[model samples]
Each structure stands twice: as C-alpha cells, then as structure tokens.
Target: MEAHRIFFERPFDYKYAREYSGTLMTPTLWITAAYVILVFGTKAYMKDRKPFDLRRPLQLWNLGLALYSGAAFLIATKEILSTWFNKGLTATYTDINSFYEGTCGAWAYLFMISKYYELGDTAFLVLRKRPLLLMHWLHHLTTLNLVLAGYHYDTHLYSWLLWMNTFIHTLMYSYYLLASCGYRLPAGFAKKITTMQIIQFCIGLSILAHIGVLKLFTDREVHCNWRMWWGTVFMEILYLTLFSHFYYVSYIKDGGKKFVRDQNEKKQVKAQ
Candidate 1:
C-alpha cells in the first residue's frame, strides 16, 4: 500500500522521473496496440453481440474533462492575477521563467503529469470503435512530449500558451459535458467551439513566432528556451492544419452537404 501510494501519489518526484518521460512513448504505443487487437478481436469474440453502448463511459469522460478544465482555469487565473495585479504586468510578463519555476512550478508539474491520465480518452475511443483519426492520436502523443520538453527547459513563454489553452479547454470540455448529458447545444455554438480552437492555435503560433523573431534581431540577451518554443510552435502548426482539415470535411465537403440535404428532407417530410 505504501508503494502504491508513492507510485500514484508522488508521481512528480525526480526518483520517478523516467516514468514521466516514458509516458510519451508507452501510452501511445499501448493504445495503438490495444486498438488494433480489439478491432480484430471484437470481430471474432462478439460477432453476434450488440454494439457497445458508450453513454456511461462518455459521461465519465465528460466528468473528467470538467475536472481538468476547472483545475486548468484555477491555475491560470491564479497565475495571471498574481502576476498582473500584484507583481506588475511588465515584471511578470518579462520574467515568466522565474514565475513558473517559483510561484506556479508545482502546479505546472502536476498539470504535466495529468497528461498521462488523459491517455484514457483515447482508450475509450478505441473501446467504442470510434475512428481513430491521426490527428487525435498525434495530438495526444505529441502533447505528452511537449509537456516533458517544456518542463525540461522551464520555458517562460509557455505560460501564455497554457493560460490560453486553459480558457479554451473550459469551453471545449463544458461543451463535451453538456453533450454527454444529452443536451443539444446550438449548431452555431459547436461551430464557435471549433473556431475558438483555431484561434487558440493562431494566437499560440504568433506568440512563439514573435519570440523567435526577438531571439533573432534584438540586442537583448533573450533566453532561448528552444525546447518549449519549438515544441509548442510545431504542435500548434500541426493542430492548425489538422483542425482546419477536420472543419472543412465536417462542414464543407460532400459529407457535410449530404447532412444538410438530409436535414432539409426530414424537415420537408415533417411539414407534409
């Protein structure tokens, strides 16, 4: 029991550091292997059984998302308010490295560790036989890498990205929670959620690019925290591209057109 407590409770300790790094590789590989096996195994094992009912699991997922988003929001708000009002914006803004390492360091480490917990999201998708898009898995896998790299470098600029992501996730996960509870939000709101994600990526990319430029041209001896900067920029670009494709396919392509046509047909039938 003590060993279990140490393993599960104190995951952030350096003695267990390799476990954190191993998370970047192990979860994705295990998830992928499990998915492939299940895809094939399900065909043989439950050919006649009814399809899996995902409602309960989805609700659990929604609850998890709510908790994660709430924690993220609280962390971001605490950092922002303390930095902005108490310490002055310029000082807080300029010295992000110090802020993260000193004030919010432990929380950031906790959040980073939580990424491993989130691997369960993909596990549910596989269990439900949901199509595992490359973007989905890539996002999960690379995010683990990003968090690990960010901690290693202790990058200051990452705070802004974390803050913005926390805000967006509050909405994103709330939407998921509502949907899981069988509440149908407006179609416009769904579109807005996608738009918010896109905007997050755009803002994140711009910030990293700005820092990169500053490193290039300025006389100021800017700290080149390459791990955080490059990892974030690369991931943001990938997210932007992947989400743009998903949006186009979901809202503009042949599938989207067919969906609209079907809705119109149903409406006409009801009118009759």
Candidate 2:
C-alpha cells in the first residue's frame, strides 16, 4: 500500500472518540427533547409578538456556520480523496483504519460535536418569526441524535454522510448568509438548493444499497453495522419523501407562480 500525506496531523484516538460519543448518547437525547419543547414554546410565545428585526445577528450566525461548513468540507474531502488516491475506493470502506485511525477520525469527532452548535439555527428562525416548518425543526433534532449515534457506533458509513452533509451545509448556509445580507439570487435558485438536497438523499440511498449488496451477495468484508445502516436508510428515505413533497408543494404543484411572484417582488423592492 502506498502512503499518503495525512492532512490531519494530530494523532487520532478512535477509541476515545467512540467512547466519548457513546457517553453523550443519553445526554443528547435529553437535550434534543428539551430543544423540541423549547422550539415549540418559543414559536407559541412569538405568535402574537411583533417579529424582532434580527438582521445583523442572523447574518453573523449564517456567516459563521457557512465558514465552518466550508472549512470542514474541504478538510474532509482532502482526507477522503487522499485515501482514495493512495488506497483505492474500497479501502476507504472496508479498511476500518482508514476512517477511524486517520486524520478524518479527528474531524469526524468534531463534526459530531458541531451538531450541537447547529441547533442555534432554529433559534434564529424562531426569533425572527420565520415560518418554521416541521421538517426544519425535526431535521435539527434528528441530526443531533443521529450524529451522536453514528459516532458511538463507529460506523465507517459516516464518512459518506459527514462528507455529503458538510458539503450541502456549506452551500446551504452560504445561501442563507447571502440572503441575510439583503442579496437574493435569481429566481429558482432556492429550488435548486432543495433539488441538490434531494439528489444527495438519493445518492446516499444508492450507496447504502450498493453496500448492502456487497455485504450480502459477495464475499467482501464490509464493516457497517446493521442498526446504523438501517437507521440511515430509514432517515434518508424519510428525508427524500419529505423534501420531494416540499418541492412539489413549493414549486411544481402550483407551477411556482406564487414563489416566482414573491421573488420578483423582492427584486423589484431592491431595485427601487
């Protein structure tokens, strides 16, 4: 096997990462429960109150998250590609050491911790009286627990999820940041972001299916745990369904006439 330069210079202690994440499992659930309660409570509290103009805070929050996701995406991509170049694609999957013992492991641990920070996104939405959808809050709550569980299980499959998620979030948060600064992309751009999300879910499902086939039909040794694999599949499938419905409702069903009209209005206001 050829050696590749490791981007994560610090020694990765997979054992400690896994054990620490495992310890957080119980606490994370408790926190998520409280988060759900708080989200709804705040939403109700703000129902009659005038929406606060939180433009500056929202911009700063989005800017911070966008930068964080962008940096994480680049590091993860570099780490994974280095392994793929040196060891071949299969090594990244079957070789536990590649994911858990390398620099990516360190980042993966940090990625898991970052989910907690991400919950603040909902805080901004609620405070601003933005129309909070079920998908928005549910996603935040579920992802926090899912990442915690994924790390605790030490599933090699997390490489795919973490890489794709950070990439999506980089784009997603960057878009939000720009919008917060009073810059709106041309019409249909928002839909494109959702489209990318749908594609991501589809690709994730395909990868899981491919791995399942390899594990079941072939003699290849795969390291994915059944619970993690099934859990991911279920979650991705649910997200696909929800997001597809969202696309249909927001764009397709009504021909996106209202959506486009709203965008044009915003643009016109900016023009004036």
Please provide TM-scores, in order, for all candidate models, with all chains considered together.
0.73, 0.89
List model 2 lDDT by residue over 49-91, tens digit each. Answer: 9877788998898888888788878877887787788987865
lDDT of 1 by residue, 1-272 (tens): 13243234543343343245444455555654665575457545545555466777788886776677677668767877777787665434345544454335555665666666666676666665545677777777677667666654555665666676667767877787786676756766766777788888897777677777777777544444766567678789999999888778767798577446644653554355
Which residue runs does candidate 2 get wrong by more than 4 Å? 1-10, 94-96, 261-272
Model 1: ten consecutive residues of lowest lDDT: 1-10
What are the clashing pairs of model 2? none
How does each model score on lDDT? 0.64, 0.79
